[model samples]
Target: MTDVVVPATGYVIISASPDFSCPDSRRYYRDKGIMQGKTVIYGDIISAEERRAMKKGFAGKLANLVWRRDKTLFAPDESCAAVFVDLDDPRFANPEFLVSLATAGEQVRVIGKSDRNDIQDTIKVSKLGVAEVLTSEQCLTRLHDLLNEVEEIATASEHRDTRYTIDALIGSSPQIKEIRKTIRLLAEVDFPSALILGETGSGKSLVSRILHNTGLRGKHNLVEVNCSAIPDELFESELFGHVKGAFTDAKNEKTGLFEFAQEGTLFLDEVGNLSPSAQAKLLKVLEDKKLRKVGSVEEKDISVRVVAATNVDLHEAIRAGQFREDLYFRLNLLTIEIPPLRQRPEDIRDLIEYYLNQFAVLYNKGTIRFSENAIEDMTAYAWPGNIRELCNVVERAVLLTHRDEITAKDIRSALKRGRITAAERRQLTIELPPQGVSLEDVQAQVIKRVLDMFNWNKTEAARYLQISRPRLRRIIQAAGLEQNRRRP
Candidate 1:
């Protein structure tokens, strides 16, 4: 007899015997509230073809399947959660079939008719990875325990899968490795505030997220605020939200960033950009751990970890009397400095490969690669704008390149064209080889020299050379002088 129960609002009971008995089993399950209702199927009345079809239809729907001396009714697949095998069944003697039934992530139980020791010995010798071995009398209790255990394991695994860890920050350089270790250690502690300092495109925001997601407060909300972007007039209202009718335009009560991040983390990016008044107000909140809504008398207590990031030099700002020294000290309890892309050139190849594979999939372009010379040029260039610049360069190259492999010329063109800014130009000085350069080489050098003189400011460079920006780009592309444009 095999009993398969598909858990829904009710239980579906499929039985192979004509009588379709097991009053005790039904009553035990019902009393335990495992099933609200039951559906019984009599295999004796149903044809073998019908039986096979029924089993196939219910293969994935079954929550539990118990096979007792029945070989004709069992169907196991990846979706089956649990299966119980009776040793008394002649089919159970096939160890290979029993092993196949216990697929990965599925639990299998073997029950012996009378000898519990024999079942244990069989399980040990068979190396079946059976979850349990018991006599027929112990089946009910053991089965109940197994179900609970499986539920708990599933819940834990699901939670683990959703979390963000330091591994997500992809780089293998020593600096990055050390940063990962520090992040892991910081997550273990309950630090109130930490300061992350890095160049504009060096992933300070990513580190902040990793800190919040891996910490003790990971289950709570993580609110981020770009301090530099918020207008001075609205800064207070945005950070410490306003009550209805607080100001002329106030419409309804609003939750503040600090309050919204209660029991979690509040990431303040570009913290040095906060106005003096805003800085003082924020300092008071950090000291008191409370904030009153704009135009409200009542104050609410807040408990949130503060993680602040900045590309600015706060020490210089403090000396210039722009930033508050006390607030800086408070936020700098633990400081982490993210190294710029230029300083960690060794990781550039990995980063390029990573983003190439990523954007290839994103754009549905199959397997993109860079020429050896292109890789060499990329690694040699100073990524002044850091990872952001590299990302833009790679994205543009992937979009524009027609061939499977991005050439050196393609990379140079992308890097030079993408980074041009309207700025003062820098003069270039080049020395010709003793053997003397080719006419084409000299022309390339002269065009490159003029472009560099204009700081790759395409408009200014073209104006100085008396050509259009598009025409200048084409000329630079033709001469293979694009490499010189990114130097400054």
Candidate 2:
């Protein structure tokens, strides 16, 4: 895909589809600010086959941008196809691109010459970005809706002076004990530098806070920096402090985390995202026990204990050269591995009870307990998002329940966002000979499942598999499934 397979001079814009926004078409126009009255140029690159079908095979145009007028046919009026591209840089592909987690039905921009909305039909797409797709008008509407919802629900969990202890961490399982023991050991030994590794939404922050609150650093400041939330340019000032007049924006002298947490703990969350330059500075600070703030020539001694947490493996990051090897070594003086919620079913009940109390007090609502079936169903769920998802689900139930109890319907509402049938879910996994039927039967079933997934749209399904539509129909017929042959 990285190879430049597209022609730069002539590109075709033949669109109108039910399925996707081709990234090949928009790879060039990701940063196109706006197009109001701008003059634009277009071009045409036609295969000999399409050239022969001009006018005769054509469909009516709905608007300037193409439309999906028919189920399975496409044609151009007069010319083979007109491709729109910005005259400024005819190579339509933009350099910026977004990385997606790869989910079906998710919209993605593509770069190619076969079809398009604007100038991209010409110059090859060189860049693309996965980004917010909302127009300015839609964004304003959504903001309005959000504002209304905020007024309807005034959810503020006020802090209590209740004693915070490691015991509040919850769970008595072996897996839970391992995490507690690690924290206890870290606190007992007074480890200066450490890392906690866990998946997103896992309670790495809770563990770090528990460690600080119950340990020697309990009395001192416990400053936390979420590396994921920090701007790249301000990392130095944010972490190491800055002197007045350091830069245009540095209007006043500021004390940084290292200075503010002088005899305390500095919790670095999502430390995996730190820039290499930032990582180097952090390594120097850990090694020398001193930090030089941005715009400050003089270094100051710091007694901050670093506790970093990341969802990614630092060793892999080192191999990719996105992280500093020395910084990894220094921060990893001690490590705590927090297991995800899916792996600890024994603690779901405890978490349910714990969060129930939290929500009751936070929302100032009467105490609500989960029904037996609700608890069982929750524990049965895989919890791919871990504790954070659980907490959100519980909070939602506590707000909506009329009685002092939660029902399965509450959990169902949140989970039913994406509903797949038992058969549909079964189709995702191939069963082995222990229970499955003959190989031919399984093959036919899987083929039917995939075809259904594409909604009996043979051409679309074939494109998904990168195969010819005619060939796919032949296979379906060969399997004695002539009914599977797509109509229109």
Tell me, by TM-score, which candidate is best: 1
TM-score of each: 0.57, 0.55
Off-target runs (Cα >4 Å) in candidate 2 are 1-163, 417-488
lDDT of 2 at 339: 81
Off by over 4 Å in 1: 1-163, 420-488
Q: In candidate 1, what are the lDDT values of residues 1-488, reduced to their tens digit? A: 11223211000011111111345644543343233211111112223543453344344432444333344433443233444555445555466655554433323222222234463455342344333344543554334334333343334423342224777687889999999999989888988999999877778987987888788877565777777645566567767888999997566676777876788788899899889999999999999999999999998999999999998889999999999999999999999999887678888998889789866754556877988778887887666566877887897798678899998889877866786333312323244889887887777766765664455678987898787889888877887776555542
lDDT of each: 0.64, 0.56
- Using lDDT, give the best candidate's number: 1
Question: What is the C-alpha lDDT profile of model 2 across 72-127, one tens digit per residue?
Answer: 11221112111222222333323331111111112222223332333332222321
Q: In model 1, which range of ten residues has the least summed lDDT?
A: 9-18
